[model samples]
Target: MTSEEEGLRFPILIGDVGGTNARFAIVDSPDSEAGEPRIVRTAEFATIDEAIAGSILRDAPVLPNSAVIAVAGPVDGDAIALTNCPWVVRPKGMFNSLGLSDVVVLNDFEAQALAVIALGVEHMEKIGGGTPETDAARVVLGPGTGLGVAGLIYSRGRWIPVPGEGGHMDIGPRSPRDFEIFPHLEPIEGRISGEQILCGRGLVSSYRAVAAADGKTPRFTTPAEITAAALECTDAVAEEALAFFVTCLGRTAGDLALVFKSQGGVFLTGGIAQKIVPALRESRFRAAFEDKAPHSQMMAGMPVYVITHPLAALAGLAAYARKPDQFGVATRGRRWRA
Candidate 1:
């Protein structure tokens, strides 16, 4: 194995860079337990380098010599600007800015995929479906500032993460109600993408569309407000919108499951899933998911779960940092060395 494949340097800086929040942790050694990550808003810093310098460097237990970062965009070239946020991340720039000898940048959901392997039953709640087949492929997706999708394949001796912009895939009206709401939902580049109905802003947009369809005004402007109203049964529009969100998530997840034939499982990560468990449990999510015709029986056996662990991405990075040989993370094009 190559030296880079052997391992990254100790005191490695691990990060999960999402569109809205960038979480960072320091793995001091192979046996070191990761502490609470230092989370800073993406809006608080113009660039990733500046965020690391301001939020992670000053208080890190020890200066890190290397890093493994997951970002919410395609991992290619040296410069990465997140798909949903404005901050740009330059790995070559991190060498002088963060004092790193090695840096590995990967798609954010790839980190989520890694976490799916490491996280145990306790960190997740099964939303529905049957047993997960051991060693089978797995899928993970979630709605935060954007919708992220990834898959995990257990190969000859290691787990490989497959990340893609599956969130941008086409979605359409499957139900009679969907016909009414789908037309009003906002679209990106003139067509409704999965992310158009699945992300944070998407929830608010869908809520507004629901209101407009019913000849009423939207009362909630944020995802949190809509979720709270749905949970409390305080607003009909919020309740319907939240339930619709759950259904869309289930359908999208099932679509991804079919894409990978992920019998291992489909994991729901991020805060939105964790917050709206009630709706997920009670909504038409399962029905919509299983409505895929002749393959419905096959999809029925695939488990769906809500990941409850807060620092899943960091946990994934630490695993990769601690034992690089265990996961076949493709760092060929993305890894940079000083």
Candidate 2:
């Protein structure tokens, strides 16, 4: 164990809360491994309190002294609300309700950024041929219920996370096929954004758009159905939709890499990426990622991988909870500590 983890108090509660699920775990001490995470479907609970009380805390061996929660939204103000879920996470309220002394909330992608350093080759599947620069910036972004983006910069012997709402950025067509499908998306979303074509909802939207472009009617209403059909080659429109989705994801990922100059690498995570790994391996994804002129060579040299860890965000939150100063994460909520 590192010296940074030596000073943390025992029984820390950590969580990775997203639109679709809430995963929680407990670490007996900073130096000890976090326990197996208990996952709860977000739709089953009306509030964060109910989910926590009914799941992770229900059969706990001991009460936690502190907590760190990685939430899927911006975490700047006093009011912490999830972008896609109805739950609102208030630090002070949680402190009082859970009877915890300290609580720290982090943006979900920020947690992902922190987890990048802890990830090993075993946890990653390479998407392209490139070596990661040890000291440069690394980016992590992927589509799930929504698109999440974050960057990690190495400085002063530590990694700092940079979080932002990158998924909402406007996205445009890059290829002839993309152009053909663009008009169809405009009707679903007035102005197409990265999230419009790269997320779960986006997957369904892509199927509808591709079906219309192919002069056929869509039979799949959910992303899961479309993905299954596409993978099985049971529906031509679904296959086309999946291809389009992968290409758009690659284009957006490349854009993020350029913006962050992530020579260290780009790591893809989230539910959608994992489920569509086969589709992402197709040529279109890599081709689109390296399509930028004059910088195509530079882009090719940047390593890309898909993160396969199930509890990466939770582990990241635990890491930050152990040493907030090392990560440069603001521990404002710790002020509530008794």
Candidate 3:
């Protein structure tokens, strides 16, 4: 490991912190997998320190001295706040209070991007497209607490993760039916961003918009309710909402693929993508994805897969801890050393 890779000690705590839940595990030694994660609802605890103390430290077999965390928001300055959740993370306070030596935080999708390079075949379910080109640029995206997007590139024989707020990009109606429902979809900053209809609450809003378009009251108020009703074929409006959600996801994925020329493949990670595998495997997603004009043929040749690993983010963090030289992960701004 180079000087830039210095400071992550043995028995490190690795976590994937999102808006709704936080999953944590311990990497005991070199080249070992992260231990089974302890997942807890974010709202159940007031802060990250409290959550870790209550859920992980209390029952841990071995205490971790350092930590590498992936949070669902920008990691800058002394304090990092989650984009969707209310918790604020102060690395110095955490290491001090928990008796740790160091801490590193990353954008949630950046960890997902690293997970793509670390994960094997057993952890992935292919959705569409042809063979993935080895060592080529790729995209990793997920719709969960929010629509997260990141890119992965291979340069200087190292895998680098590029994380950003690609979820907030503008999305407009493409079809006659979309024209009807999109107008009803809620907007932030006076226009519809992808997160307006991609995340959990965003999906609920989409369902409501679908109902509003037809001048009918929505039967489902939550994403779970709408997804359950759609999967069971219990409600036509719910089904339509699911279709809209997946189609938009595919469109956005395709757009990113175009921008990055992601021939290495496009990976979908997060609870939502894993839960909706059946819907995503259907024709709607691939159809919208391959609908890119003039570049339809190019889009058809790129592969897309859904990550099936339950604790994928921790796996990524552990892999980097085990071999920091292998991945060109940017940890400078987020890393803290005592």
The model with the greatest lDDT is 3
Write the residue-wise lDDT of candidate 1 on 39-141 in tens digits: 9999989889888888878877689998899999998789888998898888898888888989989999999999998788999999889999999999999
Rate residue 216 of model 3 by lDDT: 91
lDDT for 286 (candidate 1): 84
Residue 307 CA displacement from its true place in model 2, Å: 0.5
Question: Candidate 3: where are CA atoms >4 Å away?
Answer: none
TM-score of 1: 0.98
Candidate 3: TM-score? Answer: 0.97
**Candidate 2 residue-wise lDDT at 178:** 77
In the range 37-84, model 3's lDDT, one tens digit per residue, is: 899999999999999999989999999999988999888887999999
Query: How accurate locally is residue 260 in candidate 2, as Cα lDDT from 0 to 100?
Result: 91
- Alpha carbon lDDT of residue 62, candidate 1? 84
Who is ahead in TM-score, 1 or 3?
1
Q: Which regions of candidate 1 fall more than 4 Å away from where they truly are?
A: none
Model 3 residue 338 lDDT score: 82
Q: For candidate 3, what is the lDDT?
A: 0.90
Rank list by TM-score: 1, 3, 2
TM-score of each candidate?
Answer: 0.98, 0.94, 0.97
